[model samples]
Target: MNQPLHLMTPEVRANPYPLYAELRRRPVCQVEPGGMWAVSRYDDVVTVLKDARRFSSAGLGQSFRPPWLEHNPTADSLVMKDPPDHTRLRTMLSRAFSGSALSRWESSIRAIAEELAEATVRRQEVDFVAEFAMPLPARVLNLFYGLEPSMALRLKRWADDLVSIPASQPSPQRMEEIRHSLAEMERCFNALIEARRASPGEDLVSELIRTEALTHEELLGFLFGLVPAGVETTVYLLANTMYVLSEHPREMERVRDNPALIPRLVEEVLRYEPPGQSSLRLTTEDVELSGVTIPRGAIVIALMGAAMRDESRFPQADRFIIDREAQSNLAFGHGPHFCLGAMLARMEARLGLEALFSRIRGFSLQRRDFAWSQSIIARGPLTLPLHLEPSRR
Candidate 1:
C-alpha cells in the first residue's frame, strides 16, 4: 500500500539507516519501483544471500531494471557467478590474496600505517581519504605483489572511475573510459605476468603465475579484480572509520591510549561502516520470500547497508558504537562470494586506526570542508580533512 521510502530519492544511498527504520515497519514486500522489486527486510535479504538453490546470483545480472537506470549492462560480474565456476575462480584468486596465508603482512601493514601517521603528526593536517586512506592499502597491496608504485596509482584511478556510481546510467563517454581503463589495467597485468614468469617472487602475482588451475587470462582477471576491490573498498572502510573516530572523541581516545584495541575497534568499524555493500541475486524459479511472491528470474539486491542497520537484528542499529560484540556485518559479503581479502582489510584498518590515534595528539573533522562520496554502492567521505590540535608530547 506504500512506496518504499528508499525508492523515492537517493536518501537511501545518502543516509540509509533512517529509511531502514521506516522499512522495518513493514520489512518484506515486493517494492515495485518501475517493475523491479526490492526486498528490504533483514530476514528476506539474508535468505537471498544464503539460499543459492532457490535464488541464483547468475541470473540476477541485468535481471531487473528500474525506470531510472539507463543502459548499464547488468551482466554477471565476479560476484554473480555460481557453482563450480564461482568456486574455481574464487579459489584461484583466493590462493593469491586470501588473508590467512598472509598473516605476516600485519607487521608491514603496521609499519606503513605508522609511517603515514608520523608524516601527518608533524604537519598537523591531512586529507585522510587521499593522503592516508587511498594510498595506504593501495600501495601496500601493490608493494606486496611487487608492482611498481606508479602503476599502482594509475590502476587505483582507473578503479575509481570503473566503480564510481554514475549520476544516471553511464554515458557512452563513461563506458569508453571504463574500456580504456580496463585495457590499461590488462596491459599492466600482462607486463607483470611476463616478469613473474621469468623470475617469480613470493608475491600473489608470482603465486598465481604458478597455479595449475588458473590460466593466464583468468589470472589477469583475478589480479584485475584486486584493482578495484583492494583500493576502493579499503578507501571507504578507512574513511568511515576515521569519520567515526573524529565524531566520537572518547571512543577515538580509548583506542589511542591502548593500541591493542585496534582489532576490536576494526571489527566494530566493519559492523558500523562496512566498506563493501549490496550483493545481488535472482529468483531462479517462482518462490515465496517473507510473504512476498518473487517471480521467476526476478532480481533481488540485498543492501548490506540496509541489512546491517535492521533493528530487529541490531538494536539501536543507527548508532556507531565500537568494542561491542556485533555479528559480522555483510560488508565483505556472505555465502560463496565473501571478500577474499577480508582478513587483510581488517588488519589494515586496525593497524591504520592504531597508528593514526597514537600519533595525532588530537584529531577531529574539519567540518567546513567535510564532504561525502556520492556513489550508488558506497557511503564514505571524499576528503576527511581532519584538523589536528598537534601532538604536544
Candidate 2:
C-alpha cells in the first residue's frame, strides 16, 4: 500500500494540490496521524457531501469539540447536524441570508469596501491581508450583527483560534488561547443575545431574536460559528483574489479594463484557489467509493481542494483561467450544508475587488515567499505585502 497522506505537515498545508493529485489517483485513501479516509475525486467528494445519511456531518461536531474546547458553539451548530435537525435549524436561519435580506446591506458593503480600498492605496505599501482583506468582512459582519467597531479585534482573534483548532495539535499555550477565546466569545454573545431580547433592532441578531426559533444556546452557537464562517472565509477569499491578480498580470488587466469581469474572476479564483480546503464527514454504513470499501463508523475527509481541480471536471486545472466555463465548484461546499453565507461572501469579494481595482492601477507582491494560514481546513496568505499603483484616471 502507498504511504498514507500526512495532511497536517507544513508542506502539505502550504501547497496540498500536488499531494491531492496523487491521492485523487486512488480516490479513496488513508490520511495518516488519525487513519481517517480521504475522498479526493470530484464525484466522490460530492457523494460524501450530498449523501448525509451515508456520511454523517456529526464528524464536524467531533472536530469542533476537541479536548481544549470543552464546548464550542460549532459543535452544536447547523453544520454539525443532520436532518431533520439540520433541516429545521437551516430553515430558521435561512431568512437572515436571503436575497432580500442581503440586498439591504449592499450599499453599506460597497461603502466599507471603497473606504478601506482608499485607505489601503494611500499607504502605497502595506500588508494587504491586514489592511484590506481582514477588515472588510469583519466590518460587514459587525454591521450585520450591530456590533461595535471596538469588538472587531477580539472577534478576529477568536476567529483565528476557532479555525486553527482542527489544523494541528495545539501547543499548551495555543490550547489555553483557544479555551480563552471560546470563553470570551460565549460571554460576549450571551450579553448580545440578552440585549437583543430586551430591545430588538434592525440587525440580524435582533431579527433572529424576534423569531424566537432558536434557544439561547442555539443562538449562541450560531453566532459562534458565524465569527469564523462569516469573517475568515471571506478574508481568505479577498486575500486569494489579490494574490491571484498579482501573479497573473493579464487577468488583472482584463479585470481593470472591464470591471464586469470581476464576478467571473471571483468565480474562477474560488475554483482555482478556494478559501476552504476540506470538510470532514463520518460514514454511517460500509461505503464503497471508486472501487474502495470504507468501513462503517470511519472518519472521512472530503478534499474540496483536490476535487475542484479534478482533471476530468476542470481542464487545465492547475492554471488560473479567468474565463473558464461557468460551473459549480465546492469552494462554498455542496449539498444540504452548503455555506449559509455564500451570497454574502461572493458579494464581499466582488465589491471588495471592484473598490480596489477602481482606485489602483495595479498591485504587485512585495515578497515572493509568504506564510500561509496555519489552518488545514482553510488556505490563504497570512500576510500579503503589496505595493499598490494608483490609477491615472
Q: What is the C-alpha RMSD of each candidate to the true structure, in Å?
A: 3.5, 1.3
Q: Summarize candidate 2's per-residue lDDT along 1-393 as a digit string, tens digits.
A: 577778878888788888998998888988875898999999999999999899998666877787766778878877888988889989999999999999999999999999999999999899999999999999898888898987876788888888777735888998888888888888888898889889989999999998888988888888888888888889999999889888899889989989999999999999989998888888999999999999999989898999999989999999999888898999989999999999999999999999999998888999968988877678999999999999987
Residues 102-132, candidate 1, lDDT per residue (tens digit)? 7767787788789877787676667778778
Best by lDDT: 2
Per-model TM values vs. the true structure: 0.88, 0.97
Model 1 misplacement above 4 A = 7-10, 30-35, 59-77, 98-100, 165-168
Q: Show the colliding residue pairs in model 2.
A: none
Judge candidate 2 at residue 186 and give its lDDT. 83
Error of 1 at 145 (Å): 3.3
Model 2 TM: 0.97
- The numbered model that scores best in TM-score is 2
Report lDDT (Cα) of residue 135, candidate 1. 79
